[model samples]
Target: MRAKNSFLLLAVILLSGCFVSKDTPKKEAKEDPYEINNQQDNRSLADVLRKYSSLTIQGDGNNARIYIRGQSTISLETQPLFIVNNTNMGRNYAAVNSSINANEIVSVRILRSLSETAIYGEEGNHGVIIIKTKNANK
Candidate 1:
């Protein structure tokens, strides 16, 4: 009887230790509106931007359009903080990203609300279009 009791106690302790108090990381209270992951370049852009193509994405495999708002422009020298792979993308980044390299993008996220705009400060006055690539790596 004592051996059985001891074995039961030991099992209980072992099982108790294995259980974690946390429940699914407690789920964040609230996520930031603009708190986004590192924008990747995993898009399927097969066609390059040609003449006067309205800002259209994820349409056909051809005719990709690169988006750039005026507020993102800085001192006429640098454009908006084009962030990609955590690296500030240059103007060429759009050219390269939109070029018919691999495939067209899957989708584009436009953040215009003050909640989203406030993060970028004045730089996002014109608005912000977060480009998410289709197949690009992080």
Candidate 2:
């Protein structure tokens, strides 16, 4: 009777161990490029571009030239195509630099790969700097 009771208790303990809950490891969420951060306030568009490892900025301020590291300039235009709020601002860096403030930008995306820039056609060949302003719809 003592041995049977001990065996029953052991079986219950083993069964309870098997029924224990296990925590499932969670998958990390991917970072979104378009997600605007509150920390970017009062910053210039050029300052934001500097954060990217694939980009190279030459000169300073209004004369600043942005270049994608691996891409070669196929035409006389050295600057990349600037698209602000879906409007093509051409290859003129000054127009984009002077018009848009850093604080006004909701998101800044650089399309360097041919596959990514192909949608913009020939103008995006050198690469493309797409800026989404807070008042994009306005």
TM-score of each: 0.34, 0.73
Write candidate 1's Cα lDDT for 1-138 as tens digits.
Answer: 999999999999999988877664776688544333334455343232211133333344433334433333445543333444334344443454544233333334555455875777765554455544544463
Q: Which tens-of-lDDT digit does each residue in 1-138 have in candidate 2?
A: 999999999999889877635685677898786655758556666787788877898876788888877888656776788999999999888778899887777788888899999998998898898889888999
Per-prediction RMSD in angstroms?
A: 12.8, 6.8
Specify the poorest-scoring 10-residue window by lDDT in model 1: 46-55
Tell me the spans in candidate 2 whose CA falls farther than 4 Å from its real position: 1-25
Local distance difference test, per candidate? Answer: 0.46, 0.83
- Best model number under lDDT: 2
* Candidate 2 global TM-score: 0.73
